[model samples]
Target: MSKRKQNLVGYLFALPWFIGFSVFLAYPLVASIYFSFCDYSVLKKPVFIGLDNYRELFADEVFWITVKNTAIYAAISLPAGMVMALGLAMLLNAKVPGTTFFRTVFFLPSLVPMVSLAVLWLWILNGEHGVLNEVLRMVGIRGPNWLGDPAWSKPALVVLGVWGVGNAVLIYLAGLQDVPTSLVEAAELDGASPWQKTRHVTIPMISPVILFNLIMGIIGTLQVFTVPYVMFPGGSPARSTYFYAMYLFDNAFLYNKMGYASALAWVIFAIILVLTGIQFLLARKWVHYEAGR
Candidate 1:
């Protein structure tokens, strides 16, 4: 076949996805960008307000609170969850019996629906009648009002976030398996201890994967909503766990401020874009790729 015919065939094959992307993803994003500058109540028409939505966001206490809470949640969960995932992956990578069983046990939590897990945690972390509190009481430690207290709500969500580390662990495990064994053996033969070998060889080899995880973890945590949204039953006791996405949801749905919500969504998009850009800028110094070198 001629190259022109091949090109036409490829275009035909990709037609559905291209059409869907244009209609669903691209159109909504463009529409939201337009809406962000307007005031729309869904029932009525949009009136252009020029940056008023953004101007109002700066002074809105709830917006700032949601930003702070979201930042804290992302900061706490990203590194913490990634580290836990790496540790679990390392454990699973070791030669041992029942390795598959352990992997299965650790990963089972990720299989459960987020809504279901949040409901389960609500019952288990209740201030008085919680299973977690009961366990703590058995050990004579007073369990704080987890969902009721603003101090504990975000932290409790972070704890719940750890349960999702299984997905990260699975990714890290694949990376670990792909690491070059020769480098490890060479380090070992040079009288380097296991710790030294891991620090020098294992880590560097998997640095790309680490970078991948770091970026994805940051993005995922920044957009976190499910655990906090459902666990607290309306932004927690004092809006402590009210994430930016949750606030966006409230504005769009509960309050019917679609235009403002679009503005908030765009702001989130900008934040994520900046963060991902920063990660790319910094990756040059630390994220090693052997093939690239």
Candidate 2:
């Protein structure tokens, strides 16, 4: 084909994707920005309202509650999940019998659908007659009401978050496998114990992977919705389990506050952006990369 004809053909091939992007992703994002500054509902024409939505959102008690809940959940779950995943990854990386089988068993939970996982955990964490409580009773310890008590509710969700760290474990396992055997051997030659070697060598080598998982965990934990929504309907037990995303969803759908929801979404986007920037800045201190990386 001639040069111009070839260029036209290429454009034709790219047109579908360009159109889809413009219509779906780009348009919705732009529309949301406009809607955020208006008094909008699905059934009514949006009326420009300046900063009213943002002002109202800031004053909403439930908004503050959801923010606190989300922050606390992320603070607890992020580190806990990362540590658990890294530990499991290290264990799986070791040469042991049935390692593949154990890896598969551990990873299967992550493959389960989120809704199904939530329902399954719902049964396990039931205040009475749950399998966890049953096991605790067998050990002569009474298990507290996991989903019922506000004090324990967030912790229960944290347990659920930790249970689904199989994906992170796989990522960590990859990083572990990539560590330089020579470095580990040098540490051993220096009479470093396993714990010392892991602390000094393995972790530092895998710092990049740890940073990736940390950023992902922050995003996921901040937007936690489906699991908690399914397990703790309406953030019951006094809304202690209510989170930012859940509150946004309720505002948009249940309360028909699209403008407010849009504003809340923009705030969420800003928070994620700022936090991610902070992580990138702090990563310079510890996230090491090989030369030419």
Candidate 3:
């Protein structure tokens, strides 16, 4: 085969992915950008209304409420999940009996389908007949309405978020296993306590993985949906659990405000981009790589 034929063959192999990207990803993204500037309803043609959707979003009180709710959830859940996951990973990283079994048990929650998990948690956190409240009742303490009260609803969702930190645990476990033994041994020789070994050696070595998990956790928590949607339906009591993604979903589907939804989606995209960028920038100071060492 000649050079041109080989080139053609390579292009043929890449064509499917290129076509899919154009049709599925690129086109929709471009369309959404256009739609964001328009007044689009699913049933009717989109009318150009530059910045109207954005202006409405800025003026919309519920928009700010959802933003606040989403930010708080992400802020709390991200760090909490990271801490839980890292602790679990460290525990399992120890040479204990049945470590594999314990790892599997802890990681199993993440494998449960989101819808099923949501349903299970609904029953578990039920105000009256739930297992959690029952335990509290047995201990002579009454549990608050987890899914009902505005104050506790977001916290209940945070618990659910942390339960799925099994995924992060696995990631951290991998990072822990990859940490250089020589460094740990050196720390041990210097009379470093276990906590000191972990703080001075293990954690610094796994800083990259920590950064990775932090970024992913931030993104996931910010885009949290199904669980809250299933548990609370539209919005929780006083709209306390009305997250940004949920509100965006309502705008697009329930209210037939595709333009507003598009704007909201772009805003979310921008927020995620900015946050991830900031994380990367800050990682330079604390996230030590082997190359840096």
TM-score of each: 0.98, 0.95, 0.97
Please say which candidate is ahead in TM-score: 1 or 2.
1
Return the TM-score for candidate 3, rounded to 2 decimals. Answer: 0.97
How high is the lDDT of residue 62 in model 1? 97
RMSD of each: 1.0, 1.7, 1.2
TM-score of 2: 0.95
Mind giving the per-residue lDDT tens digits that candidate 1 earns over 120-211? 99899999999999999999999999989888888899899998899999999999999888888888789999889888888888989998
In the range 1-293, model 3's lDDT, one tens digit per residue, is: 99999999999999999999999999999999999999998789999999999999999999999999999999899989999999999999999799999999998998999999999999999998999999999999999999899999999999999999988999999999999999999889999998899888999999999999999988899999999999998787889999999999999999999999999999999999999999999999999999974
lDDT of 3 at 233: 85
Deviating ranges (above 4 Å) for candidate 3: 1-4
lDDT of 2 by residue, 221-279 (tens): 99999999999889988999999999999989999989999999999999999999999
* Count of steric clashes across candidates, in order: 0, 0, 0
Q: Give the C-alpha miss distance for residue 223 in model 2, angstroms.
A: 0.1
RMSD of 3: 1.2
